[model samples]
Target chain A: QKEVEQDPGPLSVPEGAIVSLNCTYSNSAFQYFMWYRQYSRKGPELLMYTYSSGNKEDGRFTAQVDKSSKYISLFIRDSQPSDSATYLCAMIRDNYGQNFVFGPGTRLSVLP
Target chain B: DARVTQTPRHKVTEMGQEVTMRCQPILGHNTVFWYRQTMMQGLELLAYFRNRAPLDDSGMPKDRFSAEMPDATLATLKIQPSEPRDSAVYFCASGLTRQGRNEKLFFGSGTQLSVL
Candidate 1:
């Protein structure tokens, strides 16, 4: 199985709606979880970052991690058209930023 | 406004040619990473360096791929005898790696490569 796996979703949603993107991993060693957003033809940019299992909120975005289940999720509240992008989940095995792995990414589109 | 910069925003070369991609990391960032993004594979880490020394490159195909940090500010990834499968967007990311903290990576716009 892949180290990290996410549904490559072209999930369409209306503006102001809440969107949830998720990723599951087979490796329990992953300690740091991150969410990156990428626009078309652009590089992925860090959106949210969390360590271990809990929640980290940054403005309208929240990242959740469940180490027990090896799952991570990113939730966008009050989504906007500008929020349309591909969301990739990344994880690191340790504190040194080594053994980094990324998921397949889910493509999201928030329409007006 | 400081961001990682990548050169030759787009490159088109024939198969068997040598393709070199360059990156100018943000100043004061001690860690550099090279990644490739494709539709089939979302984003793959090719290699990474810490303090100008290569730490890991196992993700790269050593037969035709090589990465190096010649100086503090510059990093390069070269693919010799490039093949069609080598056509993918190459990205360079830079960050400050703390001893006990997670690093926040800043990625460049990426170099779109097309090997014909």
Candidate 2:
């Protein structure tokens, strides 16, 4: 099994709809979870970051981590067209300088 | 706003030619990472450096690829005799590893490479 896995979604949704993006990992050692957003022809930018097995909220985005299930999720509330992009989930072990394991990003399009 | 900078936003080279991608990491950030992104493989970590020393490069092909940090500000990835499969967007990211913990990463616009 891949270390990290995500549905490569070209998930389409109307503006203002709630979108939930999820990832599952095979490694139980992953401690830090992050979500990155990439626009067309642009580099990815950090969208949300969380360490613990709970939810972290920032404005319209919420990041949730569940260590027991080895699953993580990012929820976008009242999404906008500007939110249309590829969302990548990344995780890393607690070891110092450990490389991050990234999931195959899910492409999202919030249509108007 | 401080951000990582990469040169040659686009590169096209014939097979067997050498290609070098450069990155100027954010000043004061001690950690630098090089990643290659493709539709089939997603984002793959190629190499990384900490305090100008290579920390890990297991993901890279040692025979044809080499990464180095000449100074605190500059890092380079070179592919000698590039192949068509080497075509991918390469991104440089910098982060401050505080207390041995990897912090948030700031990525550059990336070098879109096409090896024909």
Candidate 3:
């Protein structure tokens, strides 16, 4: 099985709605969790970062990690059309210089 | 806005031809990485360098692929006798390492390669 799994969603939501994206992993060794955003024809950009099992908030975005359950989530409040993009979840071990493992990504669209 | 820079933003080549992609990492970053993205694989790390020395390249296909950091500013990924299966968007990323902390990576726009 793949170490990481995410729903490849083309989830459509209206503007001003709340959006939630998530991923699950089987590797308990993964300690660093991250979320990246990618627009069409562009490289992925880091959106949210969290360490271990806890929640981290940045403006309209909040990242939550539950290590025991091997699940991670990203929440977007009052979403906008500009927020339409693909969301990918990534994880890495605490070791230095280790490469990241990314999920398949979820495509989202916020309609105006 | 210092960011990783990749050359030949798009490449199209016939099968069995050689391909070379380049990257200019953000100045002062100590680590550089090469990655490929596709619908099937998502994003996969092909190789990485720390302090201008290769740390790991096990993810790359050794027979036809090579990665090198010729200097602090330049890194390259070359594929010889490329195949159709080698088509994907290749990305370069750089990070400033810190002990006991997770490094934040900044990625380049990437080179979209099509091996016909």
Candidate 4:
């Protein structure tokens, strides 16, 4: 099984709606969780980051990590057309140096 | 804004040719990473370096793929005898430290490679 799993969603939402993107993983060793946003032809950009099992908020984006369930989520409030992009979840162990594992991103489109 | 820089924004090479992609990490960032993105495989970590020293590269195919950080400023990923399946966008990202899990990664636009 892949270390991380996410729905390859082409989810569409209306402007001003709330958007939630999620991922699940089988590796309990993953302690660092992150969310990245990538527009077409662009590289993944860091959106939100969290450590262990907790929530971190940044502007309109909220990242939640549940270590017990090995699940992570990113919530966007009052979404805008500019927020339309692919959201990717990534995880790594907390050790000094470790490689990251990324999930298949969820594509989101916010329409007017 | 300090950003990672990658060369040859787009590359189209014939199969079995040697392909080399380069990256210049953000100044002062000690960690550099190479990733491959494809429609079916999503994003795969091919290799990473810490302080110009390789920490992990198991994700890469040892026979054909190689990664190196010859100096603090440059990192490279080379694929020889490239196959058609090697066609994908290659990304380079740099981080400040290996200690902070929350440390933000600065990414380059990416190198779109097509092996025909």
Highest DockQ scorer: 2
Off by over 4 Å in 4: B98-102
Deviating ranges (above 4 Å) for candidate 1 = A95-97, B100-102
Q: Which DockQ-derived CAPRI band holds candidate 3?
A: medium
Better of 2 and 4 by DockQ: 2
TM-score for candidate 1, residues paired by index = 0.96
Model 3 chain B worst lDDT run, 10 consecutive residues = B97-106
> Quick one: how many clashes does candidate 2 have?
0
lDDT (C-alpha) at residue B8 in model 1: 84
Clashes by residue pair, model 2: none
Q: Of the candidates numbered 1 and 2, which has the greater TM-score value?
A: 2
Error of 1 at B72 (Å): 0.7
lDDT of 3 at A9: 87
For each candidate, the alpha-carbon lDDT, in order, equals 0.92, 0.95, 0.92, 0.90
For residues A1-108, what per-residue lDDT tens digits would candidate 4 score against the true structure?
A: 888999998999999999999999998888878899999999999888778678888999999988888899999999999999999998877766777778999999
Candidate 1 per-residue C-alpha lDDT over B1-116 given as tens digits, one digit per residue, 9 for 90 to 100 = 99999998999999999999999999999999999999988789899998998989999999999999999999999999899999999999998888944488889999999999
Tens-digit per-residue lDDT, A12-81, candidate 3: 9999999999999998989989999999888889999789788999999999999999999999999999
Query: By TM-score, who's the top model here?
Result: 2
- Tens digits of per-residue lDDT for model 3 on B71-96? 99999999998999999999999988
Model 2: docking quality category: high
TM-score for chain B of each model, two decimals:
0.97, 0.99, 0.97, 0.95
Model 2 bad stretches (over 4 Å): none
Estimate TM-scores for all models. Answer: 0.96, 0.98, 0.97, 0.95
Task: State the weakest 10-residue window (summed lDDT) of model 4 chain B.
Answer: B97-106
- lDDT for residue B40 in candidate 3, whole number 0-100: 85
